[model samples]
Target chain A: MSTRTVDLVDYDDAVRRYDPVLGIEVHVELGTVTKMFCGAEVEFGGEPNTQVTPVSLGLPGALPVVNRTAVESAIKIGLALNCSIAESCRFARKNYFYPDNPKNFQTSQYDEPIAFDGYLDVELEDGTVFRVEIERAHMEEDAGKNTHVGGAGGRISGAEYSLVDYNRAGIPLVEIVTRPIEGVGERAPEIARAYVKTLRDIFRALDVSEARMERGNVRADVNLSLRATPESPLGTRTETKNVNSFRSVERAVRYEVSRQAALLDAGDAVVQETRHWHEDRGVTSSGRVKSDAEDYRYFPEPDLVPVAPARSWVESLRAAQPELPVERRRRLQGEWGYADAEMRDVVNADAIDIIEATVAAGSSPAGARKWWMGELARRAKSAEVELAELPVTPGQVAQLQGLVDSGRINDKLARQALEGVLAGEGDPEQVVVARGLEVVSDDGPLLEAIDAALAAQPDIAEKIRSGNLGPVGAIIGAVMKATRGQADAGRVRELVIERTSA
Target chain B: MSTISRDEVARVAALARIDLRPDELDRLAGELDVIVDSVAQVSAVATPDVPATSHPLPMTNVYREDVPVPALPVADVLAAAPDAQDGRFAVPQILGEE
Candidate 1:
């Protein structure tokens, strides 16, 4: 395992001495109900192999058939990435003998891919557009999961046995491989993160995949190599497998650059191998070496037919596309009449998705923004959780705003109800019922409170009758205090004016 | 065809996780040369106009609707495995090797 080397060159020194080249291969599991080549259902968590079909299990007589929605989703992803749609593609058997693959071969694309020569304009958080050139995005079937058990942390080493779940075996995947990304020295990590984030956003916008990195839907393999200079030939690269989050992607890139630079500096060559990214430890350990001699013996699958997408169908998919994120953000900013600073705050607070969903749930843009970016955001910050992971849903936020719009509660009470909902007090209405946080719209009780306030502050009430009405603030404040701030302030003002005028 | 070497064959065999005897490596080197030459003979005659065809038959748009179908029972699925435990297919722990 290289004995856990701590001699990593400084990041600035590493970039100065060597040019880092990045080749990111993103694997996205399609959200199709069925498996890629079989009738096995695709689910996130299922009991063992219960979702496995005979084709997924690689039974002798079982035949393979492709899922139509998976192909359409692949095409949509390609279109979103500005990739050229392939006229024809075929599945090839990637021969490997692992316990995870029941058939001992994965059906993947090799020479022919469904999408080729694409480029994605990845805009970093600083609004710099780095064009990451995509080599190809091809169709592949995912391997079954192997859970190594009986060891400390269930590591593969010292484990007594490993459990294999074939439920994900035949799930459809679009493996997007990028051409070697070069020349963005210190910003390499940021570029990598932004690129993946852009891909995730595009996937979600296209409604292709769930695109959850935590659930293994969208995974990125960071392939980084460091050369002495920009003109130097590419150094032997190490591929870090399945970095599952945006933060980890950036960290992996930076870690690889430093690690590889250290090896090169010490007169040791970086081995061309796959490395396992330990997210917990934040360090990559060496995996299998991708030797030139170790061939997968890729050949066309005999059971499945070739896929030749019609140009008309591809065009139709492009025409039916939803608004992508960048354009959508611009449209939203215009539609909501938000200034640049306002939009930036909304985006920075990570409130875009919640606000969008809240708006979709029948709340005004201003109302959604005020609730999500204001009170909910404050609570979410103090709670140290994401806005989406808050106890209250976007629907509840809209409901809370609806109560305010219907005069059931004013803004202040709505804030309390939102707080109550976030505290697991059920939805806004239930919170209103449980906490009794509502506006006192009844004039009878409000008038009685106003009369008491007037009784308490008769001198200020008399000053209002002679047209010096400034001291009426004490009467309104007194009434508000009596009603526990639930009395509508506007109504209290009008009632105080009426009681003083007589 | 490139001349195959015994050492190269041995290295490739090790990479493939196959234990090969010295004599068997020598025998496979000679056998693989013939196979490589035979495969090269066909490629020489095929013209560039013929695009590379991976599939045996030319077809397109072969897809099934995404729908629920009966999966094999867990017992049936686990029946073919070398080992099973807790309704899961079990294997010797992979010690970070092939």
Candidate 2:
């Protein structure tokens, strides 16, 4: 397919003319202890070939045995999305030739998936509920990761050679495919992002996979098409493969809409193929032409048998789902007394979990929100790092707030202590001690400094004794300067007033 | 009569990434006929009385416990590979990302 060929119609114009159909396919690796079809364990990155068994390597005599935990996780995901679990389903072999897939064929479900016909009610930032239909969530095995070495980075395009890590090979994955979502006119990009983010939250709540989008634990393939009218035939769709992050998912949908509209506006047929999401360029490039090579001669796998989950098993898994992200957000928003905008801010910052932990560690909800949303967030942004990856933990932040609450440190010193704690000076208390940041609560040292300040500023002290406290700042400033800004100013003022009046 | 042609076998061999000489290609063409016929014969044995079967044995949910067994030694896994570097299976340039 030609990319950036003609000037694309603007986003507003495109949506006004054509209806966008969004189809999302999310593949999540089940964090099971063992590989799907082998005795080998499933680890993310080990010595490259160490995690593979003969079965994973697709050796001559090795056979596969399914991992029960993977099947259970798939069913649980289906139930959370409000899907009907299949009573009986068998594995099918998807035949293709890829070097990463040592088996040369992937063991997946074709027509007979284990779960189907589900719907996920996704709530956007503005609380707009969009119900996305689920086509199926099928069980499959992942291919090995290809790391091409001997170039700038480990990219396969210009690399001298590639490395294969079979640690990921044969790992169980649940591919959740969504039906063609329609009726979302201009909110198409927002809907795509919200749906994927909701699904990630559900996965984490279920404890299925780690569901880290940046790490490729949960990957999405976005299929987008445009039609002239809502009733017209669907236009040729392009599948953008493995858009990694939530933000990228939204950008991919928006980019494809403009690109495809441009192609159609120029009287060019959008070639039906897969494209690559270039995160650096914020554009898509044509990867390969989709042809009969996609005809993956699917047939039932002979090495394995049919899986018919007991009704009781499916029910038990469904019952085990924890409170999903949306429900938790609703509850937390109420408990924390947050307005809609305030709650949206916390969710967008992705600090809901950290804020909850901080509150649990003894900081007030408002206090926790203030510290996290103000100081820590600014630090994270300035350093170009994620908030979760920041060195300070919720408990450390709670300790910092505790010092301020207990009068051991004033708000001014507390800010410096927080910086010291993040810089690895130890906890808040340790940072306070290391940096000598405690509030000067002892009035003896403060009275001595205040008496000296009064002796030096007799005129201002007399003016303060006459009940005009405006000149109290003169004595307080003198004491503050003498103590190098460590002494508490309010206590100095109190001593100055007592001495001057006597 | 074999419906498969010599050119078809060459294309299949190419996809499979095996380089074959002209004489070898001609010999492989006749071998494809035998393999196809054998597979067809297996399908022909299914009658109205018999049901479609995926495996010779009837087994479902044959799974391992959620416990990790040590992976094979690094040397053995690398031995299977044509090349290895820093305990990884290294290969030539890959043309496609998918």
Candidate 3:
């Protein structure tokens, strides 16, 4: 690896000089029950090497048979992405000497993919619809996990040794490759992030995979190159691999654009190579260099036959496709009467499901959104947790909203009750009852508090009695303070006016 | 005409992680040339009318149910490895991807 540090051009300056073209390849592991080619169970966090079969272990004389469910999942994903299903596809051997794969070759699709030629329209943060064209989505098998021992940074290099676990081997993977996405200009990073997030939502909607980035269920390989202008030829690009998060995908693209711009500004050429994304350092380091030795020399796998999905089956899968994220977002926005910006904010916060649940639990759409996008969202941010990870549930939020709508608790009292709920006190109702957060409904207690406030501030009371109603706010404030902010200010105002008139 | 060169054979051997002598590299290049020529003859007969076949059988979509079978015991699995550590297969340090 080259240790020379290069200066970076500012992102604005880089975009001013060049146009960035992006090609993203996203890999999603299918949530199948078994290995793609064997009967070994597909699971996470199992004993090391315990989930392997003879086929997964690449033992001699053992053969592999395709898993029906895995193929069905691949078809479902393809249909959701609007890709045309291939009538027949076959696997090929991608030969390498890596110990991650015990077979010394990975079984993957080549030349013939299961799905190809589709496009997805992704909604950016500002609600701009950008269509990302799909090239192909192919089926492949995952490799084993290698834990580098005695290594700095836990990379394969400089490690004393490595331990290999075959538990993840043979898990089914569907790699979706996007065609060269041009004309995005400066929005390349935003489009890249949005595209991956849209696919993740689609995968979950299709129920093909868990689609969790933290669990490595979905990973992105971001390929980016900058041209002199939109009309210029494509420049040499770098492939940054395993950018697992949406934010990381965007960051990797921007970093590459800036880094490449600096190289061009210095009159140096960009090298085409594979680079690894370091999430902590927010920079990409060079991985394997491009060379003849990197060639896979792909050939058809003689052990497995072709997969010819019937036309009827493809149509059936297409018909069974669920409402994808884009359609669902549009539907929800219309049904909730939310403006586009409001809906985008909710989606950005990842609170759509919880808000829907709150509405289903009998809260108004506006009310549910107000709590989730307002108080709860603020609380989640402050607590450094996900909106879903907040201790308060949708039902409790709806209950709190119910209390507010019924005038049993004012907004202030509702906020206190919500705090109690997040603190694990109890449900909203129990929290309100336990914390005595109910608004003052009986006029007798209000009368006593009002009398006490007027007696203490007789001059202000006189001013209110002489027809200056402004000082009546003083009485209400005193009463509210005396009542621990649980009394409704509107009702307090009415009671104070009556007392002053009498 | 030589179908495979000694350097090409050396590169393939390196990719396969095989230690090849110079003389062995030259000898294998000659042997691989014969194999390549024989394979080319088969391709020569394969015209557009005859669809290329990856498998000998005419069948397609051979699949098994997704029900899982139990895995082997850890001791049995580790027994097949040349070296084992921490219930995993241990190997020498990889020279790439830091």
Candidate 4:
């Protein structure tokens, strides 16, 4: 999180010497019920072998059936990103060696991704909107998860043995790539984070993948290079792999920018290779280099028939596109009457959907925002759960606020009831009833408690009688305490005033 | 099209992790040449205007609900693992500690 002042003298010389350009390829696992080309369940963290089918396991006689739902999800994502859908596409083999890939080769779309030539409008916090041009978004299968144990550093070296889970294998993935981005300059890191955040929102809006960074559902591979200025030929770029979160993406990019800049300043030519972003250390280490164009031995997948989606089908998909994240943010800002900062906070917290649902459940927009952005958000953080997953319902929230509005319960009591409801005690009203938390609106019991307090504290009562109305609050507090906060303090205060005065 | 040498075919097979016998490499080289030659028909028909297609079906704007669901059970996932321990898949030692 530290930034160094660029040695302008060195940078000036380097600028005359070199320029940096960047590109990013992001892979998002679609939240499909099944695998891309098989019926095996598309899930993460499963009992390793249970989800695999013959096709996903790459059985000798197995044939990929092409999950229709996964294809549709890919198309939706493509259109949401403002990409053009190709009328016809075919699957090709991407051959590679890795034990995690059961097939030893992946079935992917090479030249014919589902969508291409799109752009994503990413807005930084400073209101600078960068149009990241999309090169393509292609559909492919994910490899299994590998656990390299007993390695010297838990990497591929000195490993005694390795294990892999195929639960992630064959899961549908849409890799959205961006062309080398220029003019990002110093804003490179911010732009990187914002772009991925915006993409997460779009995925949520389009109902594609869950886009959970922690679970590796959506991952970013940041390609970074450093140059003196915008006008020079691009320098060699490094690819950082599997950055799972926006923060890491930004950090990785910024680190690479500095590292590469420093390297270039030292007159060292930047190496074109893959790097690993160690999130813990906030530095990138070397991975394998692509010395040559890897010949994947790609060819048409003979097992499955070629997909020939009709023009009408593509049109229908386009028509069915959901409101993209940018549009949704703008609309929600206007509809909720929230300031730009507040809306941005909601988006950053990933609570826009929850707030929207709460509003839809009859809560005032401002009220919904307040609760979600405040107590609910706090509770979600404490429990490590999403805001929407909290047990309290929107109707209950509105009903609790309604109780406060009608003076039937104080704010503190309402909060207590909320906790009760969140604990599965029931709705707001039910929690209030079950806990005997309703205010003593009748005032009879409150007056009796106030009298008892007065008898116990004669000097304080005399002070109240001597026109010290502030002391009346003492009696009100006593009465409320006696009645376990069920007595309305305001009404008790009024009774205490009248009695003390008389 | 360049003719694939037997040595080249063997190297590719090694990279792909498929063990091929010396005799098999030549046969594979011939077969690969034939396949590559046949598939090169794409180049003949492909014009600058003819876009290479990667997906068989034309699709755009497909989506699914973005809700996070439970990951598959660790036990279930590990059941398929060739090796596992302590609820995690175990693998061979990889890198020397820095």
Best by DockQ: 3
TM-score per prediction, in order, is: 0.90, 0.89, 0.94, 0.83
Order of candidates by DockQ, top first?
A: 3, 1, 2, 4
For candidate 1, lDDT tens digit of each residue in A1-502? 4555566888888988888899999999999999999888888889999999889988889888999999999999999988999998888888877888988789999888999998998877766788999999999989998888888778777787899998999999999999999887889999999889889889999999989878889999999999888999888889898899999999999889888888989999899999988888788888887745237877788888888999999999999999998888888889888888888788667677888888899888899999888887887788898888788898998999999999999998988888788788899999998898889988999999988877777787678878887987888888888988899888889888887777
Ranked by lDDT, the better of candidates 1 and 2 is 1
How high is the CA lDDT of each candidate model? 0.87, 0.86, 0.91, 0.78
The prediction achieving the highest lDDT against the true structure is 3
By the DockQ metric, which is better: model 2 or model 4? 2
The Cα error of candidate 1 at residue A360, in Å, is 4.2
lDDT accuracy of residue A219 in candidate 1: 96
Q: Write the per-residue lDDT of candidate 2 for residues A1-502, one digit (tens) a residue.
A: 3334545578888888889999999999988989888879877667678888789899998988888888888899989989999998999998887778988899999878999999999998878898999999999999998877767576556678887788889989999999999998889999999999999989988999999887899999999999999999888999999998999999999899998998888889998988899899788878776646345768899888888899999888877778888899999999999888988999999899999999899988887898899999999999988887899999999888888888888777888899898888899999899888887888888888888877887787678878888988888888888876777777777788788788
lDDT, residue B64, candidate 3 = 97
Docking level for model 1: medium
Model 3 lDDT per residue over B1-98, tens place: 89799999998898778999999998999999999999999998888999887799999999999999988888988898999998899988988853
User: Candidate 1, overall lDDT?
Assistant: 0.87
True contacts kept of each: 0.87, 0.82, 0.91, 0.26
Score residue A122 of candidate 4 by CA lDDT.
89
Which has the higher DockQ value, candidate number 1 or candidate number 2? Answer: 1
RMSD for each model, in Å, please?
A: 3.2, 3.7, 2.1, 5.7
lDDT of 4 by residue, B10-47 (tens): 87887776898888987889999988888888788789
Which wins on DockQ, candidate 1 or candidate 3? 3
